[model samples]
Target chain A: MYKEPIFLQPKFQERIWGGKKLHTEFNYTIPNDQTGEAWVISAHPNGPSVIKNGPLAGKTLADAWNDHGELFNKSKDNHEEYPLLVKILDANDDLSVQVHPNDTYACEVEGVPYGKTECWYVLSAEPGAELVIGHHAKTKDELTAMVENQNWDTFLRRVKVTAGDFVYVPSGTIHAIGKGIVILETQQSSDITYRVYDYDRTDSVGNKRELHLDRAIEVTEVPHQDADKEQSVSTVHQLTVKKLVEEKYFTVYHWHLFGQASELKLNQDFLQLV
Target chain B: MIDGEATLTVDGKTFEVEKGSHFILPHGLSDYDLSGDAEFIVSHV
Candidate 1:
């Protein structure tokens, strides 16, 4: 039996307002022969767990996932669909208020096989960093009026966030990662995001990114005011029901901790491709 | 269930496969038709 819990090095991306912070923290040491990229961890058509020691020393996580599917209960070939995409995002500037379509919407409207459902574990934040999730408007008419009249302040529920906070974002939630924050996001392997608002910011081309106005209008829920309680205060174990407002084809759990351990008993015909 | 490409010598043959990229071989191929330095992960559901 293996005694060590595998360590997954993270991947880094350079976004328009993203900082060089995530690249520095999560990347591991590479040997002289291996290559390194801004993106370190790859949930390739291959897997998520990297082999620490053996003949296949530098092989990727996907390769291990394919070879050892039975131990994790994953189907060898089809297991490529769920890549454990973990990233440390440093938002030097505010991100767009965005919503993701679930599997059904993605498959029907956009013809994507998978949709994004991600969670954020905030590692650090500035003095007044805030996250925009959902809205105070209860009805579609109120939400439309708020967006049309540019009542961004009243429409968005601004929650003051700090380090070590876990925010589960199911598909279709209108949310954004505010500036002055660094976070680790874990989610499904899909990269489809629907932007609702961009804080009126423009790209390098000097054009505002397109907003998914109609879809956001259909998907946004009433603002969740008590999002801070999602973190585990006393212990590293927190079981917050994150998908109360929206449901998806898959369920996810957020574990915020240091030196924590838990046992998982597999009773279902499912796979645990860690 | 197909053979690895590293084993095939005649080479200019292709087949349709959705599940794997490097494991398929042409018809009338057998293990004796293979050569040195060939390895592949065999999986079945």
Candidate 2:
């Protein structure tokens, strides 16, 4: 009997290199505050209600999935459909050079059901903000040589990204969100980023995260390009799909909201918190 | 005896959904279909 829209909060992680950047979680009313932790949002394996509202008011998302699995018709092996993962990435420093695997590859190689294909809506970027996307090298050996030689400037396709730009990153596209950029990312519910190159940074324990050079090479796609397509769809309301970034798996619509009540028919059982 | 059901009438047409069974009445669906005594959950997307 709830009349208002339900909102979910994005759990934040305090990394060793993380700055004073706090993730602002909006539109979620989870019952258990403990579920939103530092690194990940815990979808209780035992099944309990984490959020307080929506069509699934009293039931946990897991319980709902268990009982109404027929609604989604998910396979026997896969459980997660659409997990809520949002990040307010404060790239205070450069992130590792990374690429993502597709669902099929992840399932076969990594034994995971889903792969990550994400979109970035640039909220703001400091002047001279740049992002490394795709490989300047055409072959895997060439990229390997560049990385070993530390020829980063030649190996990366650096773009001066600014606020209000929408970027869609397909799986296998080697990319990195550079320093001084903060973004709101929405993507398929998966967490399998293969870091090809890290700037030789170490964790608090002085242990560096292993670079999956061979795996990344296998997954990396050559010739990464930006989606420079304009938001051309005309609508009466200010709500328009300004930019659309699509990969083989999921499509992200960079929506431009300007105080308009938007109406949309549900395609899959989508969870939209605010 | 069958479990109690509710039939919802909208614009002269009716929709009968059982307590356990549900139907998605598509957006802009002018005509609806039903049997008189079925109960259901209704929502617009």
CAPRI band for model 2: incorrect
Root mean square deviation (Cα) for candidate 1: 14.0
Instruction: For model 2, state the Cα shift of residue A146 in Å.
Output: 2.0
lDDT of 2 by residue, A1-274 (tens): 2222222223444444444443232222223322222212223332222434457555544554555454334446765653434445566677788899988898999887777776776766899998877778877788778867878789888888888777777788888888777666656556788887788898768999888877887887765565564444544354334325444544444433333322334454332311
Off by over 4 Å in 1: A1-9, A23-68, A76-80, A222-274, B1-45
Tens digit of lDDT per residue, candidate 1, span A1-274? 1122223343434466666554344333322211222232345442233444334346555665566454345655574453445444667788888778877787788876766766766767899899876678777788889887878888887778997566767776778889888765656666677777787887679988788788777665554333333222222122111221112332333322222122322233332211
Least well predicted 10-residue stretch by lDDT in candidate 2 chain A? A33-42
Q: Where is model 2 more than 4 Å wrong at Cα?
A: A1-4, A23-49, A54-63, A68-80, A225-230, A246-248, A257-274, B1-45
Overlapping backbone residue pairs in candidate 2 total: 8
Worst 10 contiguous positions by lDDT, candidate 1 chain A: A238-247
